[model samples]
Target: MPTLLRLHTDRPGHGSGLRLAASGEIDLSNVDDLKSALADAVAEIGSSGEELVVDLAEVEYVDSAAINVLSAYADAIHRIVVHPYLLSTLRVSGVTELVTVDPVQQ
Candidate 1:
């Protein structure tokens, strides 16, 4: 069975910045969840100019669609926290060039 993607949005207090953390696999099957979450996060942080921190540490996998969605929001995103396993994928996909990609600290 495929693991359904889960998204958690939060703001780490005043002037900290907005964040969207995603867990589980992010393939085409559940890419919309990521898109919607990003859109909602962006809308919620409207006019504040706060950077969006995308935490994908728990994400097990991601397809091109998922990368596309992240790329689409590169300007709004401050950094992306991903597992070491996914770092190469992000690098190959050019996501690392578009935005900061950090490996989750063990």
Candidate 2:
């Protein structure tokens, strides 16, 4: 079965930060989309090198491949906002160490 993933990139409302909104499951089927979304978000910010914030609020599941995708953007991702339950997934995947994981009790 194919997982459905949706990615929307836009500038942050507060500042020049890039925001990538990811919805749906993040598995092997859609991990590449996540990566492309982040990359596109960064590119949209030009040469600012400011920051990329991934909003994982609507995300339901994240697999190992998805974690690896996030790991690759560790340097560019400033913060990852996720559901409280997803905190364990990020920590276990070692993504918390690379980037900031802000768990929002949703």
Candidate 3:
């Protein structure tokens, strides 16, 4: 059996940002979970002025379904930092402009 999809979220205090840490694969099998998580994150950020930061460092894979969900929103400024590997995939898919890609320090 495949490992279950897991997403961890952290919403800091006032003036702090929101962090969504995702692990495991996000394919057709578990894209919905990711979508739900993202939706909740968006809702939380929308209510508060806090930004969003998604850490995809442990995400082994992502498919079009996951990509489509992410493409729907225009995140707040300085929000949404995608992992380097995920950033490459997003760039190739032409959705890099939709989210901010933060470079990982070596």
RMSD to the true structure for each prediction, in A, is 1.3, 1.5, 2.4
Clashing pairs in 2: none
Best by TM-score: 1
lDDT-superior candidate, 1 or 3: 1
Q: In terms of TM-score, which candidate is stronger, 1 or 2?
A: 1
TM-score of each: 0.93, 0.90, 0.80
Residues 17-105, candidate 1, lDDT per residue (tens digit)? Answer: 88899988998888888899999998988888888899999999999999999999998898999999999999999999999999999
Q: Stretches of candidate 2 above 4 Å error? A: 14-16
lDDT of 2 by residue, 1-106 (tens): 8899888887656776878898889999878788788778767776786777899988899999989889988888889999888989999889999999998665
What's each prediction's clash count? 0, 0, 0
Tell me the whole-model lDDT of each prediction, alpha carbons only: 0.92, 0.86, 0.73
State in Å the error of residue 77, model 1: 0.6
Model 3 agreement with the true structure over 1-106: per-residue lDDT tens digits: 5446789898656667888888888888888887888788888878666777776777878888877767765454344456577777888876668767665554
> Lowest summed lDDT over 10 consecutive residues: which window, candidate 2?
9-18
Worst 10 residues of 1 by lDDT: 1-10
